[model samples]
Target chain A: MRHSDQDLRTLMRAAQGGDRAAYRAALAALADWLGGYFARRIAPAQVDDLVQETLLSVHRKRSSYDPDRPFFPWVAAIARYRWIDALRARARRPETSLEAEPPVASPEEPVLARLSLDQLIGHLPAPQARAITLTKVEGRSVAETARLTGQSESAVKVNVHRGLRKLAALVESE
Target chain B: MTERLDMMIDDLAAELAPQPAVRERDGRRAALAAALVTIALVIGLLGLRPQLVNGVADALVLVTTALFALLALAAGLSAIRMAQPAVGAPRGGALWLFVAMLLFPAIALVEHLVGRPADAQAQIGLMCLLNGVGASLFTAAVIVRHLRRGAPVLPEAAGLCTGLAAGAVGAVAITLECGGSSFAHLAFFHVGIVAAWALIGRLVLARLVRW
Candidate 1:
């Protein structure tokens, strides 16, 4: 069942006072909300992990909460911050697979991932985007990517590194 | 997934202990205390200016000192509030104060353009600049240390505020101690110190505060 903002706030306020039962209940409810929040922003396979990370952040920063303020925005801000962190991590990691891995992969699976990647790359300059797509996303060797893109191998490597760094910075700014 | 979360929640709940909620005032008080401590240290090491001690400091110098003190109060409190990460938190007051603080540099620039440069005291100005930056280090450490205890969503902005507040603390101390009252001196050394810290806070402190 969905808990109202007031219910969560009341529970959280009690949790701050060392009520373990209230703390557990509030956390459970927040977990559900966080799941929904992450599910909307990230791949389904990654949503659970993001939710867990955000819940940990909530636990760590619980004391930062001001009881007099509305609770939803505070938690929401934390959730958003965690989401940015997830994006930064994704931007930094080497590409693993073009196709979606199964079990948790939706039918729309890797399409969402590709679309999001395209959206991020779309923000880059044309040469940087092409170089990154050919080298990183397509997993081509630097020499092969250079041959295909008509750029030097060093240029391709530079573009890939710079592109990824820019992507990490973009995620950071978000 | 459900079981893992349930277990995690159990662990967190089990570890939970009673603690006071972090108040906005706590950060403000800490920043104030850090600024005071730095001021005291500067007094001990460099000694307060004779003009200030003799009550002969001109109105412009006194006004400049007041501005630095006010900026430190506003930006220091705002930086602390940023750590708490509330939506719609009041930060504009500090921003406006920072903008006002830029007037010193602007005035200096205009004066230079008009060929009205003040007598340059390169040696004293250099010393004041170094002292101002040195003074900022302690206060910046205090605020950033407090920030490390909490998650700041806008880490870059929080870092900027931290630098400004800390730099202002340094400016306040050095201003009270340094004898120079020239706009060029105030702009280059006093406000310049704040600018330097603001950059460090934006670049370094942001990385440190990011969770």
Candidate 2:
């Protein structure tokens, strides 16, 4: 979040030119950002997997990015396609539910999820993180968090439980 | 999680596949060039039918030839556009053909309404239509194979456009090669090929283009 969009663009362009460290940093930032982005829209349990796929999709589609254009949209385009693909895939097999939780990263995904609080906060699903950030981290009431996030109070409460459960699962896995 | 994400980033970088830059090739140019070359060869080999001039008045022959040529060109451009992963439907570009399409059917209907009973003449050798389709298919197949690499996001649209391009070539060849100018024959065989290609694009070829 400290880097300007211009800085991100420069980082991506360097990555395109085969700067490995720059590329890694850009992807790390993107993966972290995607965690926040997806947290709001989907269940907390689904966030990590989406982040990994979006990272790969961005890597695969890097060819399509025009450096002159804004960076996020290019990344967002890949994210959108992957999201749609995931939706179609989920639709084909709707028996899966959030409560069941997902298995850890698949072979196709890079193993991710060592979390420092900043990076952990970075990696949490958007809604869960937002719910946590508002109601727990910032000490807002559940109703105020719900009002800010446009979530029902029950949904807000559920997100807090689920977000905490996600952290606990990471600890249990560790 | 910090160390894991750090290691993952490093590993991802090490394994990262840097994609080659995308250069938007002119699919339209490739398709049209292929079509024009193939149609030229078809005409040279099979010869334009002598009956074409006598079957229709000079103005109508000129008009019909122009119409078929334009249709072929339009379809060629569309096929190329649709083949690109980024470009999807032909959108507004495909509407022009409907004018020619409607005119053919409307003329046939009005002729029948005016008491000229459907004048379907003797079935001439439709050998050229088939050959034209085959030849254009070969050319289109070669060019489209590369276009497919660009990633056909709308596989159905891409396939339809590719098929329509080939069909246009076939239609043009038939225009010059068929002896019968009967409204029924031109409508059924000439224009019908494009429709067939569209269906093939939607049903058959789309699957082949997918990643």
Candidate 3:
């Protein structure tokens, strides 16, 4: 259900007051938003980790939140910062050279080709699609994704690796 | 053109906007403040003797202590409620209440300052100044904590109120001990202190609390 701004504010205030349930609800609401956000840039596997880390940070520093303002902006700002930090960390590590390139669609390409890929991605199971998006697009570490998705780190790594192979096979057959 | 494609991408990106995260840490801070106030009140009350008890002192100490404890309880309750589900969470009124609580100490300071003999007044003034500095330190800590967590100014009103409550309680305690109860002393001391606290609270809220 769509939560009103007032509802969210009340929830936030409660969360600030040390309500675990309120915090979870707030986290759930934020997860959806963050999921879509990570889907665009990072692989699906990494979104869960980013969300978890962001939530932990939010929890650790919750006392600084102001009750008067909208809660989402504060969350978004945190997420943005977290994303930047992750990017910076990746840049510093330089271990993973296998980055997913954004799809390069030329003007001359048929609309059907783009449509087919979108449809194919959509057709994948939600978990698989999410794993692929986080790992390939968002470029989050497997451990981070596992932590966010509530799966073991090994599971996340395997899922991303498997999901990518399946997607590549699908594209080749198509 | 590529511009149109970029615009579409931008629109899609905007559509997938991420919501901000919320953390519940105010309750902990409030609890800490409450605990501190309770401890302070206990110490202040324990220090009181019949000889130290004046009319103004009695009134100030009793009122400030009780009010501070009440505010502490309220803060604690808010913190408890914050731990619940979003649907079950309490309102933001508690924050405003906390802000109101911060005003009490300023009132006490003014009351104490108004009635003392000039020689005694200087000592009280110095003590008040010292207390003010301590309170400022606490306020600074609260402000920094708020900023780091990305909390807005409105929620931190509790911290402001906590300060006020502490100030009011101390002022009242001092006033009672000093034997000043006249309307002029009460007005200049209690009311004036409250007003000053209000002003300071407003200034802090505006400058530091606003995200």
Candidate 4:
């Protein structure tokens, strides 16, 4: 069964109290979320290591985690930082390949895509940006994202529905 | 292709988690080393010569012990409070404690110098000077730990260095008053204590503080 935000909060408290079971459960749940988040940006072979690094960092800094905040966002922030660190490490490595695909979409694409999406997604609300990131960027199923995110499946579905419609409308207008 | 995007997201997720084994192994090693050091120091202190123990000629030891015990209790409480999620700026409190611990020994030295009776007081003063030197070394260890953790090192280091200098001066004063011409003992022991404290501080700081 999916745990609610309140449920995750309880688990966080238990983990802070040094409950191994609660820590394990929390790690297991966050791992999937983090896995999907990193899988998009790093090589398949490196993703596992990155996920492990993020999880370990989270565990080490667990005492710093505020129970009042939703767990997934905090986990997501950690994942984001790990992603940035990985990118920096990769940048420092000597480039051996004769040809390498540019690390990301052309800078122009980000500017255009973000700007186009911002007008639309920005208008929908914060929930829509979060929902789209989970569904589109992270590729979590609506039910799973809802469970991890502590939103009701119906609430998640609505956010996804509105987000996608807004994106489609923005693209159509352009 | 959409499949590529799916694969990429999956790959990134797996890359972010740290290896559980590495974390566990490092934590275990650190905890074990700290415990071992504590045990070794306690054993070594207990093995000191009877003369050295007997030479502590006044009630100063009792007073110093009481003072340190209270300080240690306060430090322990601060550590616990800093560990809480709600505590903002843990570094601030940690820094303050470091400074206080460093200055504590110097304060004791001043109190000993200013208050003790002139004749027997010289012996007491000498003992207090030695004790202050020991405490200064301990405080240096605490400061080094803070530095290793990537915390600000300047203020704590300043406090410790100042205390060490004050302790050396106190030792010299006691030696002069006691009609002891041996600057060697004062210089060697006082400076040696500071160096030892710095070394131990580096080791403990490296072990405990997360970089």
- What are the per-residue Cα lDDT tens digits for candidate 4 across A10-62? 77777766666666666666666665566555544455678777767676566
Candidate 4, residues B1-211, lDDT tens digits: the string is 1344334434443343322112222322343343234334533643432433456532433333333334333332333222222212233333353345445445545555788412333443355345535534433343333233222212222233323322332232222223222223332333333334334334443244322
TM-score of 1: 0.81
Estimated TM-score for each candidate: 0.81, 0.63, 0.35, 0.34
lDDT score of model 1? Answer: 0.82
Tens digit per residue, CA lDDT, model 3, A1-174: 556667777877776565656655665666566655554544344555676666565555565456776666666655654654565454343325235533433432324333444565676677767765565445677766667777777676666655555554453233
Across A82-162, the per-residue lDDT of candidate 2 in tens digits comes to 554554454343233333555434432312322233355565799988876675445577777789999998898777767
Better of 1 and 3 by lDDT: 1
Q: What is the interface RMSD of candidate 2, in Å?
A: 6.3
Note the DockQ of each predicted structure. 0.48, 0.14, 0.04, 0.05
Model 4 TM-score (B-chain only): 0.34
Q: Give the TM-score of candidate 2.
A: 0.63
How displaced is residue B119 in candidate 4, in Å?
13
What's the distance in Å from true for residue B2, model 4? 12
Q: Which stretches of candidate 1 lie over 4 Å from their true place?
A: A94-100, A103-174, B40-47, B88-117
Question: Residue-wise lDDT of candidate 1 within B79-187, one digit each (tens)?
Answer: 8988786655666676688788888788888888899987546668889988899889999998998888766888988998999999999999998888887778888
Task: Return the number of clashes found in candidate 3.
Answer: 60
lDDT (tens digit, per residue) of candidate 2 on B1-211: 2465667677879875555444345455566677777777777877776765456454554566677677666656655544333312234344367345757767776887899867655255255445655665755574466455554444555576666666667777767766656666676556665656656655776777655
Error of 3 at A29 (Å): 7.4
List TM-scores of chain B, every candidate. 0.91, 0.74, 0.44, 0.34
